[model samples]
Target: MQKEIQIAQLITALQKGDVTAFDQLYFEYAPLLYNRIFKLIKSPEIVEEILQEVFLKVWNMRAQLEVDRGLKTLLCRIADNLAIDHFRKASRDRALQEELWTSSVGFYLHTEESIFDKEKQRILNEAIQLLSPKRKEILTLCNIENKSYKEVASMLGISANTVSNLLVSAMKDIKNYIHSKYEGA
Candidate 1:
């Protein structure tokens, strides 16, 4: 009960732009947040980054702090959200890498002996150019730039679902183009 009162006081002070109070709150809560984040992320480096981000968010949202709801709850919620974002990005990156690898392998295995590496690259580039501008940009962000659906959506100001659908469509079109170009080869 006493500790809760202290935390509440700190939160109240933080909301009033007290940097010292914020530092005190951080010192008291950072270890707990780090452990909670590490459970989800399992990487010290990334956990550290997310820990910093959580505090940064706390600072940014200081004015809106709800002291009655418990600071620990808010901190944990922010940490969890950041950790989930990391996982989502990592999962998307792995899937994209696998798709590119599979495409490259299939291209090599199915192409004729006369098709040199440069020619294969040229064919792939030609296929990419055939995409509509939006699809092309989506493909570049997802594959070439290695960005997550969320990142691409944020960049283009579109929904993540839209980014995902366009990427799937773009991949299919690229595959079809490559297949047709090498059908007899």
Candidate 2:
């Protein structure tokens, strides 16, 4: 009961933009949060980065925070969401890298037997240019620049899911364009 009152008082102070209260809260919860995040991320550097982002978000959105809910629960939810976001991004990046590598390797091997590398590159460029501007941007960031969906989404002021969907569509279109143009020739 006493601890609850302390937590309530901390929340009230935090909502009022009290840095000391924020620090106190961080000190009280960061370790537990770090452990939870580390279990999901499995990298100390990434865990630290996520923890910082989570607290920064909390501080930035303090005015909208609801003290009625348990602070620990709120923090844990934020941490979990961030960790899941990281996992999704890592997974997407790995898959994209593998696909790009595989395609590049096949193209390289095929080019060794023929002098069609330049033509193939041109065709790929043309196929990319056929996409919508936003889709082009997604492909550039995600495939060319090797950025994560979240990074691309943040850069484009869209949701990560939007970035993902656009990338899938763009990749499919590019593949179809290339196949139709080059398959029978």
With a 3 Å backbone cut-off (N, CA, C), the pairs that clash in candidate 1 are none
Candidate 2: tens digits of C-alpha lDDT, residues 68-159: 78889999999999999998999999999999999999988897857677778889999999999999988999988999999988999999
TM-score of each candidate structure, all chains considered together: 0.58, 0.60
What lDDT does model 2 reach? 0.93
By TM-score, the best candidate is: 2
Q: Give candidate 1 misplaced runs (Cα > 4 Å).
A: 110-185
What are the lDDT figures for the candidates, one per model?
Answer: 0.93, 0.93
Instruction: Estimate the Cα RMSD of every predicted model relative to the unseen true structure.
Output: 23.5, 24.8
lDDT of 1 by residue, 34-144 (tens): 999988878899999999999999999999998788788889999999999999999999999999999998877778544677798999999999999999999998999
